[model samples]
Target: MEGNMNYFEIFKDVSVVFFIAIPPWLALRKYLKNYLNRAFLTIFFITYIIATLLTQNVFPFILVVLCFYFAIKMKDNFEVLYYLRPIKEKKTEIILYCLFFRFIIYIINVFYASLLEYVGIKVKAQDIYEIFLNAGWIKVIFLFAMTVVFAPIVEEFTFRHILYRGLSKKIGKQLSAALTSFLFALIHYNLAGFVSFFGIGIYNCYLYEKYGYRAAVVNHFIFNFISVLLILLIKIFNIPTVMT
Candidate 1:
């Protein structure tokens, strides 16, 4: 039964990847003909694959930095940095909204874990969390940088600025946001956290549409910063609990 369940989980993940990723690619194939769009997508997927295959926690940080460097070199072609400007107004509002969403994500995580436990299945800590728990202080700081700074930049540029924008042009914005959110959640490959990620993805899309890409990026940074703080607290206190 355990083996069967593993197979089922694998099947579900593959199905999600196919349904969420392939259809959008097909729809946006022509749109991606633009050099900047194609390049950004390529960078995003390559980094994603490398980050997945390489178990070392620091690789993600390195890959994202490389991605950002390439993006900077191409700034003249796409004005990429314009979207990365810090949010100058309504800082408090953005922070509050992020905190609210973080709370909702926590509730969703707890409910999912409880449901899995009720079914006699133990919930596993997310891979990044495990990395944090096991790593030395120096490595943990690198992981924190990846989480709080670099990840948000690369992920927002790819998902919100590239994917969401391209998909919006092909489909309507509403459907585009939904599809982008679905792909964002699947890319993380955390079944137990899918709903929470999806919810945040939707919120990020909304921020992008309403306030431009900077808002989305800031939202992601705040969300991750809070998560990293909690993880640091856990490590400092030697908490026995695992977070999904």
Candidate 2:
């Protein structure tokens, strides 16, 4: 039988709006399928949505950071972090492996930037298809919130926490991680990103397998920040610092 094609093929029919219901659907499927579980999942979804929307500002960020801090502080007794279990042990080997991969991808990004320039897209450090350039402070901040804050939480939860866990239940750990990482890369929905983030997904899965969600979050946050900083340096200072 013919299998499903690439990520884009599987997702071409999926609209952006479909994602709005993802959290609830996921909670239902993963945590609450039975009557009791379903009831809890429904409430959890509602609460998660409300909390995220209501605390879209610094408050939410503060709360999340504090949670991370508490987890670090309480270390052994952090029950909540257990919710993101199967997190891998901290290991330098994988971080170094990811670092080497990222460095190569940085060169790829620069070349990709050259291609974008060919087609009249400005390949700066930051620009969404080079269409939404740094218009102003307000717009920049909005982009930051969407890409950094909202995206990391939601995407990691869905792609890694839920899907990774689901797949791990049925397959070998290594195989499930590879497949989930591939799906995560595919769902990004762009040729450039499709080329770029697959390895990132792999690294994230490695982190999940090693240090858990906290490591994933930390790696993710650092990756974004470094990318942004590199872009800004490239565009504003005319310096080309590659991804580390």
Candidate 3:
């Protein structure tokens, strides 16, 4: 077990991980010129970790500014925003398909939750929940922005569009999806909801492959939105099972 540490301690550990990983990535930039940008990634990680620690009180504002900054910078290479543009065709079909996928994923999550409970694997909510649960309105708003807005955009780009796309080029899509899904679950740093997150990750990858990155983003938003709603409902209804 690890001892308790302050934010800077954790940031130090995170920096080390990036430091160790960055060199090989930098070396491969020549080969991966089109796919990867070492500078953007380096800056992104630095901003992400520091912004997370420093801007708790002004998270939404900082994130909004950063989002626009990235959008401008990524205009040409904006694979992240490409799918988010307005759709010309199959709009209705795509939405209906996404709604259906959400339902399917929900059912899978239920079963996956049950399985985790059966095996006695603890299912922990993501840490951000505790952070914003009883905080003031600003914090609540920040949580919403983080979960429903920024998380969907950043995570979908990183896990689905970027990582899965790159990996699928080497391995087949199936293997890539599996690997990316596991990484997605792993990054959330929760053991209990691992299966649930993995299921959603694969589902998002499927949406990205079949429909578009935008579809995956919408699906991701819906998932997180629903989770937020559930948390709200639990608090409102005082659900005993989850309360303890």
Candidate 4:
């Protein structure tokens, strides 16, 4: 399996219509006090569709930021910040817990990648890392900012905070977790790693429900950071993979 496949193509697929459609729908529903009225909902949906089509590249990012802002503002409890408030006694234990679970997910991802190859799919393990590695320093900085920081804030707030919270109201926590995880995996648009992505999505949801939103965000950041670091080492040293 060659590992130099174009990952951006994953984002450009027709299925992207669904992923791109979700933010505005969910975000508007959060702010719309009259969301329960079918007529208003229909009208607003149409308006949002038109607006999204007409907007520029930065609009979606701006909408994500606004959603992040409102998600925090509307929460009755400040769980986003308060969840990780340190307890001197449990601090070490918390660190261990994150490390342990992150390690578990890493194993799961590697196994999942192998499983994909076993099933005849070629897995490009370094697609995203190569983007980081090959880009200029300034572009790499922006990529890091967009992925590790802005993306986590936007995605965690959207999927874990807003969507998960909204769904939990209508469904069981277990079902909500699974559904949210499924959607999260779907949006990534990478069939080869779908199972692995779903696993991490569920893990993040567990952290969100058990600890708080901040825990999910931190876990996401740590996962991406470790992934990039590992890939950077691999690229620099030309480490052999199963594909190689």
Off by over 4 Å in 2: 1-21, 28-80, 83-101, 108-134, 234-244
> Candidate 2's residue-wise lDDT over 119-206, tens digit each?
9865333224232233455766665665666556556656676677677889977788888778776655555555467767777787
Q: Candidate 3 — what's its lDDT?
A: 0.64
Candidate 1 per-residue lDDT, tens place, 1-244, comes to 9999899667755653444333334333333455457678888655654444443224444444454555566553454466544577867788788788888888987898789889998766567887887899999987888688766766676678778887888998999999989988877767677777788789999988767677887888887887778778888899878573
TM-score of 1: 0.68
Kindly report which residue stretches of model 3 are placed more than 4 angstroms away from their true locations once superposed: 1-49, 52-85, 241-244
RMSD of 2: 8.2
Off by over 4 Å in 4: 1-93, 238-244
lDDT, candidate 3, 1-244, per-residue tens? 3455576468655643443223223323333455558798667556655654564323323443344355556573555456445555766777677667767766776677778879987666667666555667676877788678766766676677667887998999999999989978876666656766888888888878777777787878877887787776665675644511
lDDT tens per residue, model 4, 1-244: 2333445544444333345546645665656653367787788667655554553213445666555555556662565445433344644565577778778876777787888879998877445566766777687767666666656656776678777877887997789989989998877766666776787788888877777766777777776776666755765676865321
Candidate 3 TM-score versus the reference: 0.69
Of candidate 4, the 10-residue stretch with the lowest lDDT total is 52-61
Q: How many residue pairs collide in each prediction?
A: 0, 7, 2, 0
lDDT of each: 0.70, 0.57, 0.64, 0.65
Worst ten in a row by lDDT for model 2? 123-132
> Model 1 misses residue 59 by how many Å?
9.2
